[model samples]
Target: VSRGQAGKPPGGPVPSCPPSGTKLFTSTVHCTAVLEGFERLRQDGLLCDVSLLPGDGEESFPVHRAMMASSSDYFKAMFTGGMKEQDLTQIKLHGVSGMGLRQIIDFVYTAKLSLSMESLHETLEAASFLQVLPVLDFCTEFLISETTLENCVEVGRIANTYHLAAVDRFVDGFILRNFGALSQTAGFLRLPAERLERALASDSLKRCTELQLFRATCRWLRHSGSRMRQAARLMSRIRFPLMSPQELLHEVQTKTFPRFSPGCHNLAFWRASNYQMLPPMQPVLQSERTRIRSDATHLLALGGVLRQQLLVSKELRLYDERTRLWRCLAPMEAPRYQHGIAVVGNFLFVVGGQSNYDTKGKTAVDTVFRYDPRYNRWAQVAPLNEKRTFFHLSALNGRLYAVGGRNAAGELATVECYDPSSNEWTYVARMAEPHYGHAGTVYGNLMYISGGITHDTFQKELLCYDPESDRWTQRAPMSTVRGLHCMCTVRDRLYVIGGNHFRGASDYADVLSCEFYSPAADNWTSAAPMLRGQSDVGVAVFQ
Candidate 1:
């Protein structure tokens, strides 16, 4: 430490400290002063030598080389690196708009931007070209929020052109969700066959019926004479077997299928024949064309109460197990918390949960909404026979079982099963005791419900339901009594992780301890405790 301020920083003063101690301090006010002073100099063309000219020659701006180089990597490389323009007082720039350059230069000086929806894309172009990271991030975030069906095609194309992988992936989702609508638009015809093929291959392609999807493929191919060369590749992605016999007949009636080669005409015959023979054999006799878009699954986070129960959230997120990344999906149509989710075939079902935002008084729902990830569409399904919250909805044997949970009336002991085949709920043998907040999963032929709360009392009993026998047999009990924890099975063992055990009246403590159930041994064993204790946690299996 210099005693008399000989080593003082260029920007400002430091707060006084003990004579023996050295202290480092930062001055935001001084930082702001430096940028403001440079901006004034640039505006007045003072201390400025470089004059930048855009390729269009619409306008030119005089600026300081050091100022421009400091904020932009592109300018830095051009002005300071081995580029020929490094020592040049005047430089020519291309592929950026005059207005965009003007805006970015101002933002660089003032640390403020006047961004608008109309100017956003143009600004994004300049930012990408200039390698101005901050403005680029701002533009990306803006597009993420403002992108819609009307503009998604343009946004997606631009993202693809720029090779912005994250932005491209997100915008691609928007494009797929509205592919049906876009297919009717001129933009659909303008899309390259390679891009069209990617969309058609995705199970996430939503909203378009099979017939519409088939027409979309043919439409893009017909738009350009050169496109016919890629017809087979584009057409192969359509799930022909998913079309109804009536729809297939309509395709024949429409006569829209074109034959580039002699063999192209058999598409209809093979489609019809495969449709008739394979309708019932579906899923079992799967091929690229016969396979439904949705058979693939990913980890999903459904709506729940958020922000200390002050708000009910409709946000839906997908966690890519492979990439280990979380991305937003179309949210549920309505808000729900304390809801139960189950998967049946290519669909995900959200059963009863509370709707009221107020924690003091929560309202339960009996409504059911099924989500099709292929199209990112949500449709109402049969409502549960009984409304429930903090319940267990488990899928087994092509059916959904909604186990006991709470309602406005209180904890429920009744149970019901929903058959997607029939779209109706039927009474299932009830648990001997009513409990809410229990975690349930299916292992083999039976559904296992473990650890729940009955009123204020936490439950430890593990009950296994045999659908064939219509009975729940008591299995080994958990080592700890807790509810609101999550349970999952791996390699035939049930892992119960983090919930809360009751302490005393209206008081509970987080259960850091975890346990697993071994069906082979019919007993429980302790597992390593979590570093941090949590309640009402969610667990999922990646494989």
Candidate 2:
């Protein structure tokens, strides 16, 4: 590992596979040994060919030409091309700090980097100048994982400067999730008009009403003369039809705003005012601007037991963060529990689970329902090939995946996938062992299932499913064996919340402890435990 690297390398036998000509081989000892030797040689100033200087009045590093050229495109171009520094023994790098350059050189030989928020900017500058893609990619990933409301705009600026395209997903999602708060940030006023408009157009930008969104847009326009030019473009993204008529009349119509070509601004206000005043003509007058922005999150208490009696609930309720209250929404046509819910695009998908029961004892249904929050309605879609309960449903790459869960028959190992485009379910590879009472979520385009029941025992095993290969591979397990837990991804970290763990034959206890998994380090670390022990509980990220 490189100096100051925070994580420990995964411990295991390093496997090496040789082509058809080889008989046998040992742990890829040669690769590590050779790299270590090179590192030692560099440290000892042996076989040094070039001296690379970073910035001005800083220490210079003596390194091999082949090593520098192979690892960095900037060095390759400088030393291999007809540049003036090609034949020179020493090269000076501008705008790259001594520490940053040293870190980059160390990574060239060690394949490890120490990236922290404090040093990330300088390292990104060095990597950008040196054209070290892996380092830039690492920085981008780190930015995506570490970004919060406070520094998200700074991260966005860094990404734009360095061309770290990968952080866009995290940034976009963060802005949508924190639109209400982010709009008040100083950096929000600096956001490009197109980006803000695109975000406003999404149905998932919630937690703020159309009035607040309009007020925020007005403030952005008032920030500078340049922003005033884009008022029409951005204000058009606000759904005036969703705003209250009183707000339209008092807040919008009364404000003396900037003028537009041929008085377009006044017309925009007038049109919005008309949208609210005319109810009968709303259908034909409806546009993207007329559509209400759907809330990105919904924590509903679905069918669950209250006491001794089984309470099968179809009532869909929503919890309001601002008022600290709950409200009812459109309920499901059919009542069920143990089902899996996932959101893909603008629609919410409900997968297989247990339905109403008779004297037969247990019942699991294969029914799949699609909920469109845009209209607050539910429509039955394609059913799963297998009727599974206690399963996990995850949306990956625009497809829904139903993982291991059981029915009245028995626990199942089979897995199936649903493609919304075709409205069909198809079987995928089965799990190594069937599991239930598990929790699963998607992170980095991969599906992770963890903490389930297998063979009548708690399963701490974590399994990762790759859609491209249609296979399930084992990952590091949780510290405590648990089931009936909640798993979710915060930023890029995988979190396992409250669950149940068994001590003995009849000693079952609710797990108050929680832990998170790092797919990069292939390790688990304890997180803040739940306030109270819970099982079969729901978990959703607030922001």
Candidate 3:
């Protein structure tokens, strides 16, 4: 109907319609302009006002209110939130040192910091007071990474003061692992009376014999001459009954026998005269003895569901490295599918999992039990605080960590830890998000959780938890979204085994594909595929 418009196009000789192509346009941007501008302002001392007085000495530095507020929560509140320092041109910091303030100012301007071990304590103190979390985190992580038995006690004290759970855990692990050499350490000998008693009580303290433990305790008491009153209390923690009759007489009955509690004397005498083992006098290194003497090059595929049938698998098969063939071992106490099984020392622990058989309305259970392969028996241990299914089960620093899973209220992010020494489950830090059907494995001190289901959808998340820092950090995602997978560590490398793979449109048959992750490289590589597609399967490493 618009005849005039149609005729205009013909008159322009088809007006050379522009070639079908996109116009290219770009404007140059200075990548570092903002940072450079800030640097210039700092060098020129432009518009700078307000002087900060250090805690000690006569040094004072002029700083910009806006810059200080932007960088620190403490300064932001003081300057912009109408604190007393808002109108005051000069403010005194009661705790920060002049050198520490300089470092903090440099970091605020340049987003860079040079921290030395000598200056770390002062810097961290100032940063914590100023609510500068970045520098505080940096200092904490550095200290955690550098922790050793030599400084573990000192680090423990510092970590306790700061409420740094991760560092505290690292210190505890260090003490337990190196307890054999504890007496030789001046730090252990000099530990405050309260700290020494607590450290000695840990079941994880690794000593070969009760005699050695007694000697170490005596040495610590003698070194701290003021702790004579604590001798009986400290000696009670030592397992006198674990000593052989000869050792009981020669080690304790001969030396500091009078220092021990009267109850300890009766117990030591019973062991030395009678050959009966007492419950309280059990060897602290009993687990170690079994681990050292046993050959553990056998991989066991525990109970799991097979074609809708719960393999309360009585006939357990293990891959024997020497025979290169699967060998049947003793079965579990009952059929368990979707359960967590991990080897801690000489015992294999079966943790929480589904307990019901109904495919429609199965329930999660908190039953925990341990199996000693040498004895071919299963015994119930402590139960979890919460019943969980599809949770992450990992052993780190000689303790078991159970992360997020499905509970009575549906998905949960709660985390729990099991200390074999205490034989009790305790709550630890919760995960950032609820993870069900996730694959978790430990490499060194860190636990890695890959793709999993959260809130009914498959997730591409990859998270690493640092037990020493009690913190979690997101990592590069998995190549494919998956859940209900099996993960195992072999030679420090992590391998994600068969699991249900989500292809966006729908879930594919449990994938036979596997992927290998290198923690050092922070990357994943293709691995040999499994013989069959599998989901919710158990994996074990034989070495």
Candidate 4:
């Protein structure tokens, strides 16, 4: 009788001897002698008696029987036709074991398979059914290399369903590469009209307008098709011409349609076509006249008034136009440069500006400051997380908004707001682009920002910010790009003044250009030029 290795017996006792008349070898005998003696006893017709010794029970049958049964079932399910009810249609299988059926059955039973590019497609399908995302991703990557325009749509749909952003991007790039083959396909360009409108409304339109599709659309409008009539009506409602007279004439000569009536050549076409030639005169005549009256009164009121004053830096001179003009009424408690200043009741607030560095290369003050004009005193308030300089500031409701500005690192797209009651600074939203040395003015609830530097270059982008929604929307662009500009509102109209083109190597060559922005029409029209090409000038309007 053989003994098992050292361990407790399963299910209670270990068996120590063979059944009746068995030959038992002592531990001192050699292993070969014990095996031969047992064989001889079995051959000699001597029956062996095996029984478990008390306190030496260390063998059991159920555990070994269960292990052998499990392995047998696994083999049957894998190699034999035992797993008949298991579905393999959705189950992905990979690798060639010289037998497809054998490989599939092996994978179904053991959840193991070889990975390869040729079998990736089937594997992906199976993995998706099993909800094995890691295996599915592997298969997707293998399949992505073979993807073409024909299969990209299917690939994109699957990627989108799985929320695989990387795969979706790859599919999009593939489609874009084969755009010509898919251009006329409805699936290629089909999108909701609202989405198309949004894309047109985006800054991407600045580049999209240069594309062949946009130009083709413009050309198509010249023809007398059903779309042409609809387009003409739309243009008329928006006070624009659908096509030039020459373009319309060419279209009429080339194509025939029901909307191409002879009477369509009425005075409206001539009037719309000749609108640009009406005059070279100023378009803001009425607004300018009103502005002149308001300016005269504002200058008269501010000329003699004395107000509290705070000196931010030696180069900057700030004073309240309501009172006390020339006196050092208050000392600025903190450093500020090109900051936005506002006054709510008797409290004056300054927000966000460039600061000087100390000897240890630390910033001095990039914070907001509050000053009591009544007490002629200043105190440091909250600091902005971002530092900005040469930005525009305006007050609306009870909050102060800081517009486009430049930091020591250069121009920034950041816009920040401060609440006096809370004594905290919060970043609201950013502008469409970085603009510095610009002018900002508030009318009603909207803040208008215009004319600043883009890179080292000047730009005339006119943008508006709505603090309630924390969003910036672009209006019409200004006619001229200027920096160090001043903005003032009078009679609901905004007048911009006294800014120069601070480009070129020589500073004295700056040009005098001034413009006005009309909110009602969302347009900029030329006003009287400034008396001089001046930068860093101050302007204020009050009646």
Candidate 5:
């Protein structure tokens, strides 16, 4: 017999068997040749047992039942589920176009899909109906990767309809992360009611004032061919209570189409009236120096007791070091005195204080609030576990520590720490003893608490609490005896601002003197004094 007929090579050389190490490479070559032969059988329509008649097309694709059934659940069920289609040579697919069917069938045989934006939707729909999970997965992944804020709404709708739960969630998250940008896009203007509801309910939405949200919603409704009938229903999702009344009246009432209902108007009016009834916003007290260095330093003064006006101040103010100008900030919601304020990163946290608005300073409140100067807005956060006032508030390692504040029971030596990440407060090690009005400041890694009033006695004892060690060590006493004063760290040095100092028996005064303690020298030296004497002052350092 000829060599070809004998299944032998037609080459000139007849060599001996190769080394055993080359057996794996020889097996791989044989496997590839077998796959190529199968591909040839498919292309030439050899041993074909089935035909797929794509919708409304004259051409029918001839395929093998085993190949089709192996790649698609629909074909497998037809051939094995005792269906009448099992006996037929041709199966007609309805609702799917000829091109979409071709794409799915090609992927089934080749395990590949070339998708484009133009044909992606139709192909996915066909794959979904045909139960070709691989192609459907490919299409969904492609759409998700290409999804932008401009097309996320539509993509999300499709994903939801196709029951692609994972893709749907991804689209929703993408929409929320880019909500600010998407809100102004055409996709947002045409968003369906269900998707809009999902977005409105998300607390993780980008932080924007209610006024901005209102304006953006109005813009969307006013867009061409928008369904204005849904305006009131959509606008209701907005937290109207969180907005200032002036914002509601002007931006929402005057500008929004289809005027708000009488109930909404009444709600806005009530909130506005309440805001106006509260104490006026306080402006920053400018420094005596007209011009200062080009430093970005700023000082924020929060709530305190104004003895002269008998006012429990909830006002907030910011003094710019570079410009030497003071500007007004949004006031705290609760009129407070003897509150604790500290800066942790960009946020200013206002902690426990006495609510002196009605009783003129009787009850201490446990409410805590956070201020974002970037937006000039304040929002209430998790309250303290213990209601306290005259406490020392300091931010260390991105946490707020409240130490030695008096509750209804009297002065407290208890210590509580706040973590912004969890938005909760936990009690830590107690102080050596209960002391109130004792100033606390964080310098380097340790928290230092110095002079304050405890049991009607002015203290001069200085103590340092190490967070890492969770222990307190006594430090040298301050030369001056003071209480209700403010302490801050500037340039790595400890500073004591104006405080109530006892001049003699039963004689108290607010001292204008300021002093800095150098850790290296272990001594105190006088720094520039304030323009005036002030006590219960809230000090904030912004660098």
Candidate 6:
């Protein structure tokens, strides 16, 4: 018995609904009342339209609408089993607790959340999958900004793997700044071959020479096609002097025997194997009968020498500008490049430049050929370690400082100081940057490096390297980036003259622009331009 319709016939058993107004009719009426209530609501809704407002606590409605607007495939990939639950758990357990599954869930649900390092790697993967570039960029910037020497190798590896160019550049800068420290632990720095090759091209030889890096260099040399051949040739030239005469004989015998004598029995091996059997010969012989001349005229030519009389020789001629004519005087033993000569006491020391080459095609001589005018002959002094060409060699504090130059490598920052008294070369502080086609002049104790090309890039920055501290510090930027520039000290002021400007591209013909740098203020100001645009020029102060 249940209440129905408007009345339920007191406490009597619920009568069965009837047709018309009977008890059965009342049951049918109750059923009709329920049906009519629902029909009235449907009629009103069909006639009226409902609209949502912002303050109704339904702001999330638009978001939901947007999600529904997206394709089914995208929604499933982002929020479903596509992202592994195990990965999320691992991320939380290992240091990324700050960006755990909650944040990830928020992103999946609302498509937005703040990211941190703990969640950075995960976010990057998610963003890549979701095609969100802003999030990806943020992650890359975070990695680059937080990179350190301790983690540079790991960061660089990741950057390279993902082809993040900007991150790679940042790592390179860090490595360059801490080259010496990193070199000590090069055994741990692991990077790709292309990255290492780019580093090598930029004069990163110090880094490349470390214990582990040297192995990488060897691998690069072995596999590099033409580069390998060139390196082999250069190394062969370097090893020539260390080989003994017996060893040299063996090398020649081995290499030439196949072409010269086919029936040879390992002549190279025999030459190297047996050195005691080699014989020594005496000087050449001349018969007394051949000493006499065939004619009296020829005999007269030797009469002076035969009489043992000292012969007067003609002295060397020199130009007497006051007299406006040439006159006889003591002459230089050889005509040499005025810029290539250095004077110490009574001796004129001549070091090598772009001079004669040995059979191996190495330019500049290691032999420091000395010309003593008093003796009128050239004597060889102790050789330099390597050939230096087109470099600035100056005397500083009684020793010769060979600054920057073009070596087997394009440009070199390798500085070597030569002690005239000891006749020895000792390594000195290297320059802050590798430069060639630049000029160097010593003012007091500081050596200034002006405009120069560093591996094809023009640098307008002026740097000063102090020998006392063995460090280089940036001074002031140059007014213009010019290479092959002439630098001279005029009345205690540094004057830079007629140098070419390279726009890091094509070389501009020499410019007449000139500037002077003041050491006191560490500033450069415009100066009078040179009368002519000169390239490969030299300046000397005469007292």
Which candidate should be chosen as best, given TM-score against the real structure?
1
Provide the lDDT at 234 for model 4.
Answer: 29
For residue 174, model 5's alpha carbon misses the true position, in angstroms, by: 3.4
The local distance difference test score of each candidate is 0.79, 0.81, 0.74, 0.53, 0.74, 0.52
TM-score (all chains, Cα) for each model: 0.53, 0.51, 0.48, 0.40, 0.51, 0.37
Q: Report clashes for each candidate as comma-separated counts.
A: 3, 0, 3, 21, 0, 3
Task: Answer with 4 or 5, whichever has the higher TM-score.
Answer: 5
Question: What tens-digit string does per-residue lDDT give for candidate 5 at 499-531?
Answer: 886788878888777787776677788888879
Mark the 10 consecutive residues where model 5 has the least summed lDDT: 281-290
Cα-based lDDT at residue 189, candidate 5: 78
Encode model 3's per-residue lDDT on 1-543: one tens digit a residue: 434565475344445675697888754655356656776787787777888888976687777888888889999999988788899988999899988888888888777888877887778778988988888778778878888778777787878777677777777777767777766877887566666666666656654456677788888777755777788777766665445567777777776766644655666466444422422112123432223223245677777666655434545677877778987778877667667777676467888887555322147889887876644667788899998888888878777899888866688788888887667899877878788888899888899988878877887678998888888898877777788888888996888888886665764667777888888888888888889887876677655
* Candidate 3: C-alpha lDDT: 0.74
Please give the distance, in angstroms, between residue 18's alpha carbon in candidate 2 and its true position after superposition: 22
Residue pairs in clash, model 6:
17-24, 18-24, 18-25
Stretches of candidate 1 off by over 4 Å are 1-25, 58-60, 82-84, 94-100, 114-126, 142-150, 252-254, 258-272, 278-280, 287-488, 491-543
Candidate closer to the true structure by lDDT (higher is better), 4 or 6: 4
Better of 1 and 5 by TM-score: 1
**Candidate 1 residue lDDT tens string, 290-397:** 546653567899786677647888888998866889999988989988888877665678888887663322478899888866557787877999888888889898
lDDT of 4 by residue, 1-543 (tens): 445555855455777876687687677656556445544653453543221111223321111112112334532353345553232212222322223333232343344566564665455554543344455556567557767666566666667665667777676656544544543454444322222223322322221111233333334344435545444332222222223345444543234322433344354355445532322111111121111111112121111112134333522244445674634445555455555777654356777654443211123235777664323456676787677767787888777787767665667788777766565667888876788778888888999887877777777778888877878888898777777778888876888887777456645345476777789988777887867666655577754
Better of 2 and 6 by TM-score: 2
403 Cα displacement, candidate 5 (Å): 7.5
lDDT tens readout by residue for model 2, 196-273: 887888888988888888888888888887666677677777787676778777776667444422356677777887
Candidate 4 backbone clash number: 21
Q: In angstroms, give how far residue 326 of model 2 lies from its true place.
A: 16
